[model samples]
Every structure is written in C-alpha cells, then in structure tokens.
Target: MFCGIVAGEVRAFRVTDEPDGVAFLDTRPVFKGHVLVVPRAHLVTLADLPPESITGYFGLVRRLAVAVESGLGAGGTFVAMNNRVSQSVPHLHTHVVPRTKGDGLRGFFWPRTRYADDPDATSYAERIRSALAADPA
Candidate 1:
C-alpha cells in the first residue's frame, strides 16, 4: 500500500483528483459491475480516516453509482462499507455495486462468488472503467 501517495496501485479507473485515491469495478466482482472506491492512504478502516476524507470518499461513491446506472445500464447501485466482518486488505474503502432485479446478489445476506478466469475478470473491469470514464464526477 502507498500511504499518502494518492495515485495508489491501479491507475486505469481512477476517477477523482485526490492523489491517494482511485475507484473502479473489482476485477473479480460479485456482480457485473461491482465497483470499489479506495483511498491510497494505508488505513485499516473507515474509522481511521479523517472526517473530511470520509466525506469526500462517499461523494465519489455517489458519483460512481450515477455513472454505473447511466453508462452501464444498471437498475440501481449498492454502497457499502465493511469495517468489521468483511474488511479485506485493511484499507478504508467503500463498495459501489450496481444491481438489477433477480441478479442473484443477496448482498450481505449471502456469500459472494469469486470470478474463475482472467478473461471474465477483464471484461467486467473494462465495462466499469468505460462507464466511469464516460461519466466521471
């Protein structure tokens, strides 16, 4: 993790001007366009982020939801933070997942399946990237 280094790891789907931040659909998403909004800052959870940072973080999440809905044709989106049970990687990040009726995503009610191959992963990533780029906040 690149603490205080803004740009973070992936540059492909970066949305905002914050250097230590980026967002895009997860390569192995739970659904077709499941997006992750992460800060480049190396923090364990949202509680570790400053108030202003948290505010900006969620603002980006909202922008991502709109982009996913308009550009990717998702019926709606889900914004979530897993501070306790599902905190993987120990970073202060949020998920903006696009959802549709009968998409079979049970949210936190059921476990998520990981993608099996690179090609499928790449396709989902590209789809969200294009959508985000076309309608960036």
Candidate 2:
C-alpha cells in the first residue's frame, strides 16, 4: 500500500522528496501534521538500509523533526520507527509527529485517534504540507 505511495503510482501528500528518500504526511497521523519519511527503495528494516545510506536517510528524518516542530508550532516532535516488531508496514519508515505539552500523548504506547472527518484529515495534511514548504533544508 505505502510502497505505491513512494513509487508515485498512488497519491500521497508529500512534504519533501529527495534523491535518497521521500517524506509525506501520514494518512492516519498520531497528530495533525504528523509525517513519515521513507527510503525510495524497498527496505524491510533499518538494518536492511546499507550503512552508507543511513546518514542521508536519517538526515532527512532530522530535518523533518525540525519541520514538524517549527511548522506546526509544536513544542517538539516524536520521532520513531519500528523494525519487524510493531512495524505496521514491512518497509523502513520514520515517523515524525508534532508534540506539545499536555497534548495527551503519553509514551510510545498510547491511544490513537483518527481525524475528526475527511475535511479534518485534509486540513491536517495541508498544515504539514504548507509547513514543509516554509521550513526547508
């Protein structure tokens, strides 16, 4: 499903697209403006990513974290990924979610909620989309 998003065969509201990877807003986001950064190639796990490509991939992840914070006016961001354990998709992707104090986001284990509706989801995606444009590398 997501590989299609990376391949451009499917439509995904993208935040940043680089030679090594691409960052797009998560359809089911932990928070509004939450984004997922993934490698262009198909890699099941982080260990599968060649050592040489790690830095570049993570560099974009770092940039997205900053964008998540500044763009969404968040106090910070929650950046994480699951390897085979809780990995929803079998691809290597990093989640960068905007954070704020007392936002009810507990630890890594917390409740998940969907956008209020389609319009709400669209607004959240747009917020992150525009934010990415404002904060560039």
Best by lDDT: 2
TM-score of 1: 0.73
lDDT (10s digit) by residue, model 1, range 57-122:
777777778877876688998888888576765677777877888988773863366656756656
lDDT of the candidates, in the order given: 0.67, 0.82
Give Cα distance to truth, residue 7, candidate 2, Å.
1.1
Of candidate 1, the 10-residue stretch with the lowest lDDT total is: 1-10
Query: Can you give the lDDT of residue 59 in candidate 1?
Result: 71
Q: Which of the numbered candidates is closest to the native, going by highest TM-score? A: 2
Q: In model 1, what is the error at residue 51, expressed in angstroms?
A: 1.9
Give the per-residue lDDT digits (tens) of candidate 2, residues 16-133: 7788798887777777788889999999998899999988999888878877777678999989999999998999999998888998887776556666776776666666667666
**Model 1, 36: alpha-carbon shift in Å?**
1.3
Query: lDDT at 94 for candidate 2?
Result: 90
